[model samples]
Target: MSQTILITGGAGFIGSNFIPYFMTAHPDYKIVNLDKLTYAGNLDNLKEVENNPNYTFVKGDICDETLVNALFDKYDFTGVIHFAAESHVDNSITGPRPFINTNLLGTFNLLEAARTHWFDAPNTP
Candidate 1:
């Protein structure tokens, strides 16, 4: 059976690099990349796996709970690799609100969705 994995921020530096590497290493796993396409997130970084059969790209914000839930329902992903964040220290110092919104709140939403869909429900015997 093939495994479906959700990779958030796949357009960012670390995620963009990891996606191709992970896909290459795990050919049986399909990767669903969700990126907001922020200034730091660029599709050009993911050119290598753009046409890969096991890869998919979604452009959206992690803060959007509706979209996130919809994706979870659609993919039924077996795993999630969350890399979305506001990582620039300078920017964080200059304007901290976005950092809080994206880093903390964004992570919370993903975790909440994962916990609800993956763990909270009763087990099927």
Candidate 2:
């Protein structure tokens, strides 16, 4: 079976560039895109792979632990490329709570989900 690879922020800048490149070169892998669709994340960025058989797009919050956990259970992803971070410094300066939560807590949620899902799987890496 092809390995399932989870990509957070798959619709954002760097992620938008990397996903296509990675998928093109790694045909043996499948991708599950989890994006919160922030302002910078445009659907057009991922138009190329949107309908590909190997790709799946999920729009949701990384901060939602239950959703994150359920996704892992549903997909059993073999690997994760964590690209979701609220990185705009300008926005962070304006109150910064969203940035803080989306960056740190979101990352933590991903880590926890990945750990729970992959910890005992010898083939996960």
Candidate 3:
């Protein structure tokens, strides 16, 4: 059976670099990529794996608990590779709210969703 792995910020620079390499090597593994597509994120970065059979792309807000929960319930993710964040210091300084929402609160939301889906409700399926 294939394991469902979640990649947060998979559309961003570093993360986008990782996904294709990982996907190529691990054909048996499935990836669910969640990215907010902020200014730092680019779809071109993940274009190779975007339509792969073992990959899924979701554009969303991690700060929204309901959305996070819905994603968890829908995907049944096994683990998370968190990469998403408000990466630019200048952007954060100028627009701290989005940074805070995407970094701290967003991370928290992803954490909770992972906990509920991977640990707490593992038996649901």
Candidate 4:
């Protein structure tokens, strides 16, 4: 059976490097890359696996709950590899809201979507 995985920030440095390796390592797994294409993320970084049948890229923000939930419903993701964040210390110091929104709320959205999708009764167990 093939597993579908949601990879947030796959256009970013670490994620862009990791996706290709993960795809090569797990051929049976499908990857759905969701990235907002922020300053830290670049599409050229993911050119390697862009054409792969098992790879998909979505240009969007992880902070959008509606989009995230819709993705969970549409893809029925079996797993998630979250890498999205605002990591520049200088930028954070200049403007912390983006960092907080992406790092905290974005993570929360992904976790909540996962929990709702994966559990029959999220509050149970």
| Candidate topping lDDT | 4
Model 1: per-residue lDDT, tens digit, 1-125? Answer: 77999999999999999998998899889999999998899999899999999899999989999998889889888899999998897988889998999999999999988987788757723
TM-score of 1: 0.94
lDDT score for candidate 3 against the true structure: 0.85
**Candidate 3 residue spans exceeding 4 A from truth:** 122-125
Give one digit per residue, the lDDT tens place, for model 2 in 1-125: 76999999999999999999999999889999999998878889888998899999999989999989999999888899999988879877767999888889999999988887778656757
Cα error, candidate 1, residue 118 (Å): 0.6
Q: Write the per-residue lDDT of candidate 4 for residues 1-125, one digit (tens) a residue.
A: 77999999999999999999999999899999999998889999888899999999989999999999999988889999999988897888879999899999999999999888888645547
Query: What is the C-alpha local distance difference test score of each model?
Result: 0.91, 0.90, 0.85, 0.92
Model 2: CA > 4 A from native: 120-125
- Of the pair 1 and 2, which is ahead by lDDT? 1
C-alpha lDDT of residue 100 in model 4? 91
Q: Which stretches of candidate 1 lie over 4 Å from their true place?
A: 122-125
User: Per-candidate RMSD vs. true structure?
Assistant: 1.2, 2.3, 2.1, 2.1
Candidate 4 colliding pairs: none
Better of 2 and 3 by TM-score: 2
Ranking by lDDT: 4, 1, 2, 3
CA RMSD (A), model 1: 1.2
